[model samples]
Target chain A: MPDKRCTEDEVVAELADGMTIGIGGWGSRRKPMSLVRAVARSSLRDLEVVSYGGPDVGLLCATGKVRRVVYAFCSLDSIALEPHFRRARQDGTVETFELDEGMMLLGLQAAAWRVPFLPTRVGLGSDVLEHQRDRIRTVRSPYDDGEELVAVPALPLDVALVHLHRADAAGNGQYLNVDPYFDDLFCRAAARTFLSVERVCPTEELASNGPLQSMLISRLWVDGVVEAPFGAHFTECVPDYPRDEEFQRAYAAAARDDEAWAAWRARYLDCGGHDAYRDAAGLR
Target chain B: MSGPAASVGPGPATRADHCVVALAECFRGDGEILANPIGTVPMIAGRLARASFEPDLVMTDGEARLVAGPVPVGVEAPDVIVEAWNPYRTMFDVVWSGRRHVVMGASQLDPFGNHNFAFIGDRRRPRAQLLGFRGAPGNTVNHATTYWVPDHSPRVFVPAVDVVCGIGTDRARALGPSGRFFELRAVVTNLGVLDTSGPDGRLRLRAVHPGVAPEDVQAATGFLLPMVDDLEVTRPPSAAERVLLARIDPLGLREREVRTS
Candidate 1:
């Protein structure tokens, strides 16, 4: 029988320590906060995560769930520029490989295509790509007059865990937002993809619009789907829902001191497991 | 009529005054404020942090693919908008999707109004080899493009470019609305402002901020700069704009100050 869709608890239990994981969503939009909270409570630790700019990586660091990360930038858009990522880099708590916001998609695509590298001429003079020669290698291009070029290798993911607006029990899901291509490419390249959705609606009822309908994901690539409501709050953004600026302001204010961190750690980070955190996130 | 691109003669006091005055105009009712990209980190996040014209939930660029950015504060996160280069069919989607706003930087811009993505040379090849025109042609026609010439140099504002990677008024006019529309909005330079209108491809001087002079703009430009009527000095940041700006970007981006060379 095809594997039954497991609860958030079972999913967290399956995640072992030190695995490379990919979290879903944009800056504050579409984050798998429930699953992230669930992962925080588990005994497993030090899982390296690969993600673009967002609070998910910060959440992972705040909980001590991440050991290292391969990312471009992480911050709260201005509230408090990602203090966790900044502090980690400054203190050497975690190793980081920064890329540009533009090159983010290509890197994942490179991984998904299973190609060794993808060539582009993005950061030639800028300091953004200066130190990242390891991740980005300079090579000559055939298109140019033997001019130097750069190649960014594919970033294949082990498990792609993305939060969605709706899904069916079978994992045939569709994202309500206009964009699905961001995580869509990664899902194809990853070994297994996990989808944590807000509502599990019937496939036929996904959407009536043609553009939105074309972007839906079939059940073949999705390994599991977790039903999560209000899960994208704080980390993931819902268009009409409004971002929690108050909480972000509070987090920025509190991040200034060790005492504050301790309080935060005790209150939020140190969950016994998924069930407790789920209850906190109002997930029943 | 001197023509839109021709010298109408006013510094910041006049022509560019419209754009300047219009800055706070969009925000009249409730008032919409578009944060300017001034400093580094703060500049990067300015669009999201601004109280005016704030995103209801936050959105990524392009009408097609919502390349997720970090979900805005406190609100529930959307799928998250992240930028990508060749996100497979993403570029194709953006280009094909009718009208879209894109901001990109240019190193060299010529007199004929053509932009150089390939190495800059005159009739043939007379200059150093730069990053050859990468995606200019496709993007310029495909989207409502804006060329952000960060380092405003004479070489950049040239009479003609070596390689024709991106489209200019000539190209856009040829392509019509099916192609690119807004020829040039504001050439936000370190010195002053350069905006154009007429079909002759003439560039007029719009503004010379507080310290900037018409001479400086002329000396720095690669082509003949035009003049506008009744120009005033480009006003410095207001108390409110400055305070919020500092709060957002504590670390100064690129140059140290708002006023640059």
Candidate 2:
């Protein structure tokens, strides 16, 4: 078990170019923005980012750090299209992939389960098949007597960047809300995993009161843990804290105005590290 | 079904059955429901209600637990596969894949119409792994695919996808587009409906929702959007539709607020 604390850079240092990286967040909620920025600063190129939905992936796309993306849901739930994704599609800058929310989980589950793939009727007859032709193969099962099944191949990753509510030096992380299914399995299935949390404490503390005690992150599966607060601000995690609706409104208002957007990016995103920007913005 | 989607409304000149299905509605369909995109369920319910199809739709969760009628039956934990003859089978197989039009959502939709709901990216550390590209690839080739964007923004739409979850027009063409099933049928939103025609398909505005202007739809979109001669407002829920929606969803979905305005 790791007994020492690593800096943010140390946590993300292992990433290399053309790496397939899974990010943390759900519709901007519970996302680890600190880690996303850390990846942004890194020399990694052609990073393949997979996420459920949020601005973190958008930020990667916006910065041109992302070469391609695998997503189930993107956008802040249709408030508007993500700018980078839209521009890329219109401009053909990056490659994109789409999936349904549950199917994403099952694909991961196939990897976690150590199965080559799981056959499902999820996309039995849609456009999803044409693109996933490589990943999905149709094999006739003898048991089913010539029944055609869509098999999704095993998807293993190099690293998983998971953000959480709390963790310790040993990497036992806890979530505040949104039980956040699949993230744990995702981390466990990866070769290396980095965790960003709001606090790192004794695992016992998390076990003491949290509704979910059995789902704590084990030490062996996590390599690093960085504490992050208000990490999912523009993309918010509820109850512990609400999404910054005001920020969303501001972003929405400014995103459409090029000058306003440029100014906003310069003020917040241009400065580099979260601390400098946070300090400048009067945050922690 | 052949005429414009707008002229087929409920007043007098319309057949009652046509009046119901004519208005685009979500038929709570749970048999093949994918859990993420997290909003498709409510969306379907909302659209169905808006169309005034007040029939107690079949559900995996709800009031009577039957299709289009009320009973005191609580939802039992029965295996969906075990109950292959489920009332919802028709919803996913026939309705979404049938000749009817549908507006579903996805995490990633690719050019080939192959979608992924399997893993977000690494699958190892998915922030939120939705139901693996559930029925997107299959459904697209079967129905009029109108992708809904509860979260439409730049980062989500990409040039080349890390994983192909569903096939798009380009991919459909690459796969040799003999039929219209393989391409994205449309894109529905709080703002409007996006559809297209011809080889170099441009996402066009088919219809705008109530309170949402044509310009608002234009303001929200980020692609080469096409506008129809005139757009119609998405129909809202009626009294009977609301009652059925309530009966089927009860508290399970009623209180959930819409992410979009």
- Measured by TM-score, the strongest candidate is 2
Q: Candidate 1 residues B183-227, lDDT tens each?
A: 344455556655554236555666666666788878888777777
Candidate 1: where are CA atoms >4 Å away? A1-3, A78-80, A142-148, A204-215, A236-240, A271-284, B1-208, B211-261
In candidate 2, position B238 carries an lDDT of 57
Candidate by candidate, in order, the iRMS in Å equals 13.4, 9.9
Give the share of true interchain contacts found in each model.
0.03, 0.24
User: What class would a CAPRI assessor give candidate 2's docking?
Assistant: incorrect
Fnat of candidate 1, please? Answer: 0.03
Say which candidate scores most in DockQ: 2
